[model samples]
Target: MADNQLGEFLRARRGAVSPDTVGVPAHGARRVAGLRREEVAVLAGVNADYYARLEQGRERRPSAQVLDALGHALRLDPDARAHLHRLAGTAPVLPLGRTPDRVSPALRRLLDGFPGSPAYVVNRTLDVLAANTLAEVLHSPFSDLDNLARMTFLDPAGRRFHTRWDRTAQAVVGHLRESSGLDPDSPRLRALVRTLCADSPDFAGLWHTHTVRGKTHDAKHFLHPDVGPLTLTYLALDVRDAPGQQLIVYQAEPSGPDAEALALLAALA
Candidate 1:
């Protein structure tokens, strides 16, 4: 919406953070909504004037070192840090507007090889590019629904499936926000966001928070109608030479009910 995406991003993130969160005293009434430019400069160990210039879009680009400093000062998580880097133009440039939904032959082979695990490839926006038989069984509901973002926000099934529905929803929205930063003008993402915003008040609120996060490893709890509840860990593998493609593998803990459920799901698949 804003002409300078970076400026908007910075303002959003700044507004999201509280002074107490960063160990800064809320000394007096402030004019600005969030941290003052001077406060951010102090935390980032940079000159106040320079930080102001960057926020104003006068300083278009930032060095990696400066970006890192800003990331640390902002207490940005990995996904947020990546968004900051992309906004600063410090992250590696990918092929212009390339959507990696078409599964490469090699990647398809890799998916086929993983018979034991439920695996799928997702684009930057978490669109399911491809999945193996097991993955298809595991995420059948999502496949039928289409668009992970939409499923997470708009579908009641998602609310039932995820054990930590609120937290999981936040992460999904955060990842989408990060992707939006990397490619602000992406029509598909914009459309998805607009649709979700229009349909779901919960999603709209989280989207306005402007949270960003990378696909870090995390535990997930799923309530499968057939297999019951499953507790699993996820591993996110970034595709080599593919800037935005990610291979997400889900595994159940050894000898647990989750593992048994997975076996059952795989067998049913």
Candidate 2:
């Protein structure tokens, strides 16, 4: 509900990073949430007032160099760093409300080739724009798998689907939060968040945390009812033509337990 997002995210991420983690000495019992404004300025090599202005949303546009420095100072990973650039308006962005609807036929054909791989395409807001058969089976728990965030937060069965449900929820929320910054005025995204906030307190609390992240993954664990358990190596690649879309593919090694599970599911299907 708090639309002062740049400030909120800065504050949240700051709280997450400790002074000791970044080689800043942990002084006496501090009454602050995270690093002081001056500490962040020192770490990022900027004037304290300048950094404070950015956080306060008074200075919305930060040069790429300054954003890079701030990102490094915050110890943000690649996804978070990219998110920071977007928030600072240093990245090429589509007009706020425009979201892509098309997934190329060539890409769908590519997904069809991977019969054993669970592959799908998701938009910036995590809508299931397209998917392979294996991917559909992978996400069968959601009666209508319209959006990933809705399934993750609103669906009760999400707990059983994800092995580490809590972490999965956090990651999903973080990705959604990041997407919000990428396109703040998107009606679809704003409506989804509004619904989730009203329907689920869990979602509301997580949203307030302002954690910005996306699916930058090597592997993910799942507990499927039919497959038992699976650990799939995952990749999320941007669909360059469709700016907001990502091609998410998942794989299990040949002859491995996960592969066996996939085979079994394939046979059953």
Candidate 3:
């Protein structure tokens, strides 16, 4: 078991919260960013010593009740809570090794039908396994298109492409966390993490936090060099047959400027 990883996650979550944020009154100047260990212990209904041991790797396995309490205390969302469960081996299934990365032909045909909407498939590690023509056109000259995570952090155009780069980058890392927790032994996932940790400080810092964020329907902004600017909503649907693959589709709201931009881009493509 990776005791240190769990310890690091606990510390990061602790450091992310502040006393005032959780309704605790501040007495004086503080050193750490978030609630102190004692405060977390109190809020979590556990003693400081026990919590400390859990954070220090002495306590490898925590009960479901304790983890649930900690989740509530830390204000974790559904995805984050699920990820915490996986990290603690309380999840439904723990995958043993690396999974396949192939995309089926039927899914590819479905993607091809979407001429206006941008659609693509991504693996657990956020690699773009398959994409429709519209998606390719909308992306517009990526420095590296092999992996979504790598493109978001390492590519020079990541900032311009994402528009809201900070949030988008963090979400990418969070997805990586969600994936890693479920399949801790994935060689591809481990190799990708090692490379990003070595090359990008932003990616390295976010990965340590154990913040998991599974993609859902959300507004996205992009500044394409060719199309200028576009705003769209995206949905991430799990490919039921593929264990680690997701079908993501992006489309602008009808009767909006963004939709017009999509039309123009489609014509150009």
Candidate 4:
């Protein structure tokens, strides 16, 4: 875990916000990257010294209201704001490095229930913990089904498999950011992030952005080698029995060309 993750988060977010975005007039060339320290203090309705202390790790505990104000000042989305609270030690910290390999029998049965749709279970690191037969068939382009981050950024076939590779990369990085905040002490998560940052420049750029997002309902585009182009909608639902796990189910429009493509993968499965 980082010694001062809260401070790092504040600095990254502070540098990401532009003066013009917050109505801070830019009369001359500024040396600072994003919003000046005093500018953030003023916008957040806090003292400059206090805000600086927060960023410097001199002040560790900030009230929920204060965090909320700072979140607003940083223009954080709902996920990022939640991450801010988590980093401040104000929110519930999720357990990490638990028995990630254990998938409930019921959940495994549920994945099989979706014959037409591709369904899978993933942990915080986006490891494919469990996948249905069709899901495995759909992701056949990847050399391994071990990690989504590796496949999306490192695998050569990732570019062709995911039609919207850029969007997929951003979402993957954002989701990992959220996971980092929740489980700062997870060495596995940290190592995975470091490997990606060192090996993939695209992952490095997105990781530095400090974007926080959790998987949710979204449309995904894919180009299966055997089935051609497909557009599918997916829902990512939290697994109540497993703390850091999500069950993702992907489906195409009924009787549409996408559905036919997905059916072809199902047949292959």
Number of the top candidate by lDDT?
4
Of the candidates shown, which would achieve the greatest TM-score relative to the real structure?
4
Q: 1-269 in candidate 4: lDDT tens per residue?
A: 36878888898899999898999999788998999899999999999999999989999999999999999999999999999999998898775445366899999999999998899999989999999899898999999887999999999999999999999999999999999888887888989998998999999999887888989999999998899999999999999778888999999999889988888888888
Candidate 2 lDDT over 87-130, as tens digits, reads: 77788556544668888999889889888788999987889999
Model 1, poorest ten-residue lDDT window? 138-147
**Which model is ahead, 3 or 4, in terms of lDDT?**
4
Specify the poorest-scoring 10-residue window by lDDT in model 3: 91-100
Per-residue lDDT, model 2, residue 162, is 83
The per-prediction tally of clashing pairs is 2, 0, 1, 0
User: Which parts of model 4 are misplaced by more than 4 Å?
Assistant: 95-99
Error of 4 at 38 (Å): 1.1
Per residue, candidate 1 scores C-alpha lDDT tens digits across 88-137 of 78885456656667878999999988897988888877888888999878
Pairs that collide, model 2 = none
Q: Give the TM-score of candidate 1.
A: 0.86
- For residues 1-269, could you state the per-residue lDDT of candidate 3 as single tens digits? 14476677778888888777798899888988888888999999998999999889888789889889998898888998887777777876453434458899999999998888999999888889999988988886686568988888888889879889998888899888888777777778889999999999999888877788887778888998878889999999988778778899998989989999999999988
Error of 4 at 24 (Å): 1.5
- Greater TM-score among 3 and 4 belongs to 4
For every candidate in turn, the CA RMSD to the true structure comes to 2.6, 2.3, 1.7, 1.5
Distance from true location, Cα of 119 in model 4, Å: 0.6
Clashing pairs in 4: none
